[model samples]
Target: MVKYLEAIRKELDYAYQVEMPQMDDWTEIDIQPVIRKLLVRIIGKMIVGNPACRSEEWLHLGEHFTEDFVAASIIMRLLPKWLHPMITNILPQRWRLRKGLQKTRDIVDPAVLRHEEANKKRARGEKVDEEDSMLNWVIDNAGKDQVLKILPEIVLVMFVPAAHTTAMAISNVLFDLCSHPEWAEKLRAEVTDVTNEFGLLGEKLPVRDWTGKLEFLDSFFQESQRMSQPISITPNRYAYEEVIFKDGLRIPKGALVGFVAVHNQIDPEIAPNPEVFDPTRCLRKRQSSPEERDKHLAGQPSKENFAFGYGSQACPGRNYAVAVLKMVLSRMLVDYEFKFKPGDSKPKKYHLMEFIIPDPTATLMMRKRK
Candidate 1:
C-alpha cells in the first residue's frame, strides 16, 4: 500500500513539474481529462501489474467499465435482477452497456491469463517478482477457487472503491479550493512550509516522508471528505442476530439495516456549526500526541460520523485512499497555483446519484507558481 502511494506521488510530481509546465501553451484544452488519465495510470499500476496494464486501451476500457458499472448498479437497484436482462436489452443505452462489459472483460481477462501463466511457471520452479501486484500475490498464495472468484472481484473492488472514489474526491478538493479563495492562501502557506521543511520544491520527494508531515493538508482532506462523503448511506447489511436500538427500535434476525453517514457528519450536536467548512477541527485535535490524535479520529460507530461505514464491514481501503489523496494534493499545491475562473465566485455543488457522489463540475485555472 505504501509503495502504491509512493508510485502515485511520483507520477503526480512528474505531471506537475514536467507536463503541467507546458499546459500554458494549450489554454483552450481542458485539464480535468488529463488529470483523470494520470490518476487512472498511477492507480492502475498499483492495482494491476505495471507494464501489462498501463496502456491507452486499458485506460479507456476502465473508464467505460466505470460508467457501465454505475449505470448497471443504478438500474439493478431499481429493478429486480431477474428482470434486468429484458430491461437492459431494450434500453437505448443497452448496446453501450454490453460493449462496456465486454471491454472490461477483455482488459481483465488478460491480467487473469497472465497470472495463470505466471503461476504455472512458478509451479515449475520459476521465480516471480516480489513486488508484482495484488493479482500476482493472490495467484501465488490462494487456491484455484480464490484465483477464479476472489481475483476477479478485486478488479471490480478497485474500480468502484479506488478509481471512482479517489477521482471524485480530488475533484471535490479542487472545486472547494476554487470556490473558497480565502482558504486557498492559507493552504498555499501550509504547503509552502511543508515543502520547504522537507526540501520538496523542485525536487522529487519520497511520498511516505512528505505525507507524514502534511498535518494541515491531511486535516483539509478529512474535512472535505466529511462534508462531501462519497457514499451516502452504506449498503444494506443483514443483521447477524436480533439487535435493539434506542427509542425501542428493534431489528430482528436477517433484517436489512441501513446507516446514514451524511446525517452524522452534519449533526450539529457533534460538530458544532456543522454547516461551515472548518479544516482546523481535526488539526487542533492532532496537536496533542499521535496516539491520542489517532484515537480521536478513529471514528466510532456512534450517530456521529461514519462516512467509511461502521463496524467490521467498514471500508478496508480508507487508509490507502487517504494516503493517495494527500500525496496528490500535496504535490499539486507545491507545484501549482490553482483558482476558479473569474466571476465564478460560488463553489460548484456535487451531484449525488443514490450512494455514489459525482465529482463537482467546476473549471480551475492553474499556473506554475514562480
Candidate 2:
C-alpha cells in the first residue's frame, strides 16, 4: 500500500501535465470528473500493471462497476422480498453489472493466465516480471489453478470500496479548502516547510514515511471528513447472539445495529463550535496530550469518530486511502491555486441512503503558481 503512493504521485503529475498542458491563467474546472479518472487509473495500475491500466476497457470497468453494483443493490432492496429473484433478473442494472463483469473477466483473465504461466517458469528457475501487484500476489498465494476462478472477484472487491469513497474524500477536502481559503494557505505553508526540510516534493515517489510528519495535512483531512462524513454510519453489525450493553440496553439476536457517527462528531461537548469547520481541530488535539495523539487521526475510529468503522473490523485500506489523499492534496496545494466559482460559497451535499455524496456540480478555479 505504501509503495503505491509513488504510483499515485506519478499518476497525478502525469494527469495534470497531460490534461492541462496549455493552462496559463486561472481556468475553471469541474474537477470531480478529473479526480475520478485519476483515481481509476492509479488504482488500476496498483491492482493490475502498466499497459493494462492504460486500457480504455479496463478503466471503464473499474470506474463504472461500482455505480452499476450500487444501482443493482438499491433496486434489489426496493422490490418485495419474495420478488427479489424475479426483479433482479429483469433489472437493466443487473444486465449492466453482468456486462461489466464479463468485460472485467476479459481484461483480467488473460493477465492472470500470463502471471500463472510466468509463476510456473519461475518455479523451474526461470526469470519473470517481479513487480508485486494485487493480481500477482493472488496468483502466487491462491495458485495457478484458482487464479481465473478468484482473480476477478478479488480485483472487484479491492476496487469497489476505493473507487467512490476515496474520490469523494478528496473532493470534499478540496471543497473545504476552497470554502476556507485561510486553511489552504496554512496547509500549503505546512507542505512547503515539510518538503523543504526533507526535499520530499521533488522526489519521484511520495515520501510515505514523511506523511506521518505532515501533522497539519492529516488534521485538515480529519476535520474535512469529520464535518463532511462520506458515510452517515459505520461499524454496522448484526447481533448473532442476544447481547446487552452496560446500560441495560438489550439487542435481540438477528437484529441489525449501527452507530450514528455525525452525532458524536458534531457534539458540542466533544468539539466546541462543531458547526464551524476548523481545519486544525484534530491537529490541536494531537498536540494537547501524549496519549491523545492517536485519538484524533482520521483513520482512528474511536467512539467519537466512526468514519472508518471500529475495532478489529475497521476498514483495512484506510491508511492507504489517507496516504493517497494527502499525496494528492499536498501536491495540489504545491502546484496550483484553487478557489470556488464566483457566487458559489460552498457546495451542498446530498445523501444517497446512508452515504453523504459530494456536490458533483461544483466548479473550482485553478491556475499554476508562478
What are the clashing pairs of model 1?
Answer: none
lDDT of candidate 1 over 1-370, digit per residue (tens): 6656655555555544543444442132244565666566667767776654566666776556666667666776778789987887776456765665555566667777777777787899999753466666665567656556545456656755667677777766776676666777777787778777777732556666666567776777767777777777774499999998888899999997777667777888767888898877777766777675754342233346676677787777766766677767776776666675667543544444545453335456777656
lDDT, model 1: 0.65
What would the TM-score be for candidate 1 when compared with the true structure? 0.81
Each candidate's root-mean-square deviation in Å? 3.9, 2.2
Candidate 2 Cα misplacement greater than 4 A, ranges: 19-22, 201-206, 244-248
Error of 2 at 17 (Å): 3.5
Deviation in Å, model 2, residue 90 alpha carbon: 2.4
lDDT of 2 by residue, 245-337 (tens): 999999999998988877888899888999999888898888899998776886777877888888998998898888777777787788888
Q: What is the lDDT of residue 307 in candidate 2?
A: 88
